[model samples]
Target chain A: MNAEDAGANLAREADESHGRTVAAERRALVQALILVLLTLWTFRDEVTKSVAQASTMTQAAHGLALPALAVMLLYCRRAELSRDLQKGSWWGAVLIILAVLAYAVTTWPFYVSYVRKLQFVTAFAGIALVVGGWRILWRCGPLLVLTGLAMPIGWNTYSTLSIRPETLTMDTALKALNLLPDMVVRLQGTELHYVHAGVQGVVGLGDAHNGLAAPLALASVYVFVTFSRVRPAWQSAILLIVAIPVVALGNLLRVLLHACLTVWSGAMPAEGLPRDVALVLSLVATYLVVAAASIVLDHLFVEEGGDSRVATTIRR
Target chain B: MESKDIVRTGAIRRLCSPIFGTTALILLVAAVALDPAMTALDIHFRKTSILPRVSLSAFDAATLPSFKSAPKESPFLDPHPDDDAGTRDHVLQRLQERDANGTDGQVILFVTYYSDPNDQVPHTPEVCYRQIGGVVRAIGSRTVELGQGDWPKRVEVRTVIVEQELANAAIAYVFCANGRFYTRRNEVRLALGWPGDKRVYFSKIEAVSRFERDEQPDLAMARACKLLSEVLPALLTRHFPRQADLKHRAVGAAR
Candidate 1:
């Protein structure tokens, strides 16, 4: 054959090969989507209950936005997922079996609401592994972790986890409130009682405000680490580690703000718009502080192959 | 085709294999089967009788003459509006002494009965009081003698002093599960979760009393204990089911 004809033949073969790869990826994507929907259908009751609680309960409010955040993260990492997709493993089947058995046990013989809710995430992970293999699971690990954290926790669990942070926030707020002119502050467990300018009020740092900032801050930091292009392993670790105290500081600031509002307004709005606004402000402030820290860390460290890590089209 | 393309094609082919398809089918079937299985088990368990002979609503505070029912607006009692009706029957009442000189003598009575073994043990004052912004200090358990003729002559109750900003109160509570009295929540869980007991139930009897600034803390504890002794005997006789009745119901249920 002449060189021109040979070149044309090669180009046609390459086009067909590319077409086949694209078709295969599209089929796999469709299959994965179906598996995810089936997993959701399997755990519909848990999902409904979680959504209800997330909508109504202040502590679980973060849960309402978590699935969306996870979906956003997955969408952003679509190219990475396509690049990482591989053969399914038998281990995933084993994981699915174990997760299903756990769901059954928690459902029937012993009704553990927490573990049952957790099975939704576990089953999703198993499906990911079964459909897209380990590389895809690893690629989507942060989103899965975020999804797991989004599960609605029981009050008992919330109280147990929040007690220390609540105590710290209250104690710090008490000291700060006492600094004000003619302000006498007394902390009774989670309640902050203050007498300022002859107006008596009690600001309760109840379960609603307990250590909430920390998890929120941590979740925000995780999202930052996942989305930011320059995050090395150490930098992500630093951001996560720094989030705890930043959240504590944010919680302290929130309580102080709420207390001042209560004292000045002569009204203690515990669970209404005022408290919600304060909580949101605190979370935003915490995120800002973490973001600042991330920027500082970026400046401090020299990331290797930073340009190469940027998003690239998947080529087979 | 390039080797990378070949590898990608092979991986995708493996993912679409019949083995993975069967696994997916099994998962889908399991998901579909779970709800019905859970419902069947619930039905089977509900058939085993586990209710009190007389409901907690039968409790008549008029039997105790010194205490009168206080209004709902009374700040002494914790209004637990989130009590689950499916697994728990909760009754809370604030009682004031008609002849008492001050608010120090007022008593808050809380009673809750649980028929579901799967539910967590009832919240103790240590946790509940703390949740409501009370600093709880545990004072060891003591036996409160009930002079009334019953299977048990006395019951052991745990006491805690809850210090709030505006008020200092004392709380005393006991858990009765399956004809056994327990001073701790874990003990109550053990009693309720014990095998072979088809008719399982537990009730928490809690009494709370506030004391004035100058009044002794012991006085508040004594007031709560006094109200508890009066209420316990009446509850056993009127509200809670007897052991014989429970056994008979269980036998009938089994048949």
Candidate 2:
């Protein structure tokens, strides 16, 4: 064969190989599309059913609120591609598959345990998918955590935070109030009475829930308001840290105020400014104060780069 | 295909299935791990005027459903427009109205009529109290006011001399405010001091729970026993009159 002819033949073969590669890629694209569509359609019922079930766990006011926030966040960030988009993990798929097994077990409706198992599996797997597996697809881990809000599953503040030194806080609050000026302050027999007054409240019962949601929420707002103008990351991280206790402290204050009022007034809490009204008023006040405090904090602490800590680190 | 395309191709579909799938699994595991806590609260089957009228419970499922599926407000619970709001500001105001400025030893038995909302039968108790020196305030807890002041308050407790014949049936409920529910620590009287013989079910309260238990065929005891309890009320009342009714005919003879 002539040299020119040989070169022409080689070029043709190269073209053929390139065409084959493109064809193979087209096939892969079609398959992936089909897989995505089918997965959503097939599991659509389960996804919705799971979310619906989760929504029930939240208080009536907040049942749908979390999901709404999730959607709004995505809308706000639509311009940016998420980091953890669609890398399928075996762990994630295993979760839904358990439902299939759970569903089979549930065939015997007479078996109460199996029914409960079905419910539990559905909730647990669905949540893990959203939190952990979804994290595989997203940049924001905090938002992923927020998804748990779909079901406002909460535990008693005491149960969750009991190990965090409630006794010390109670003593501090009482000491600040000048409640124990004379008698030695000691928690006895799991119950403490103001031996002088014979009035008893659990010394270590420093929980955020016992009708102090408003105050706690307010205190949290204070921390955030105190630090708002700080850099987004710093503000978020600091506010996040500050929010829980701000709310807890706010709650403690409300409780202390109520206990004091009850002892002094000799009237029922429901009667004095009324418990319900006090709760509402305190909640509103807390929001206002927290917002004001955050603004003040932002002005006082937020420097050029971020908050004082971030600035100080940069300075070094 | 390029690597980015490869990641994108499988990504979104891979994302949703497992995230939700696993969350559900974990929640299920947690639910399984948690012990079932069934509390008997809510008033439906039997009649008792002592409890507050708010029947639409925020708590769901496990407690028995109000026997009537159709929502009708109880006449008792319906807030009275005619009632003075200023007078109603305090729980004590309501308490005083209930007590009618009384004096001396009297007791009121607040018993649990039905607790399980899933209970098929029509027995719902406002609160459950066993009559052996026992007074149930709501459910899972009860309090007897020994009156304000001093150590080792002398609270009125019912003591039984004989079964079925109530010696201290005449009583009134003590007014308690703002519930404080704590975790059952060693504080829940974890001590197994004695056999539960001193405890006896209140006659009326027992009747309600029995009615509920009987509805479930599996739990139904074919044979039932009469409610046998005794009490020592702080104050005596005319409503649950002492030795007036023939039901207590056994009182003098048994003595």
lDDT of 1 by residue, A184-246 (tens): 988876677788878787875555335453455446545644354434567667766765667
- How does model 2 score by TM-score? 0.33
Q: Which runs of model 2 end up more than 4 angstroms from their true locations?
A: A1-91, A95-232, A257-267, A271-273, A281-303, A306-316, B1-255
DockQ comparisons of all candidates to the true complex: 0.26, 0.04
lDDT of 2 by residue, B102-221 (tens): 311111222221212222211112111121211112222223333333212332222211111112122222211111111221111111111121111111211111112113311111
lDDT of each residue in B68-166, candidate 1, tens digit only:
776556554445423443444666777776677444368888888887655567666766667656765445677788785775888889887866656
Show model 1 residue runs off by greater than 4 Å: A1-25, A204-230, A265-268, A303-316, B1-15, B47-121, B131-133, B136-161, B166-195, B205-255
- Could you estimate the TM-score for every candidate? 0.70, 0.33
Best by lDDT: 1
lDDT of 2 by residue, A1-316 (tens): 9999999999999999877655433433343344333333433433455556545532213334544554455444432323233334455445545654454333221223323333433433333343334553333333344433332223332222322233344445556545544323333211123423564333322222233234323432343244323234565566667666666665556545554554455544234343344345555666665666555555655454466675553233
The DockQ value obtained for model 1 is 0.26
What residue pairs are clashing in model 1?
Answer: none
Residue B28 error, candidate 2, Å: 16
Candidate 1 Cα lDDT to native: 0.70
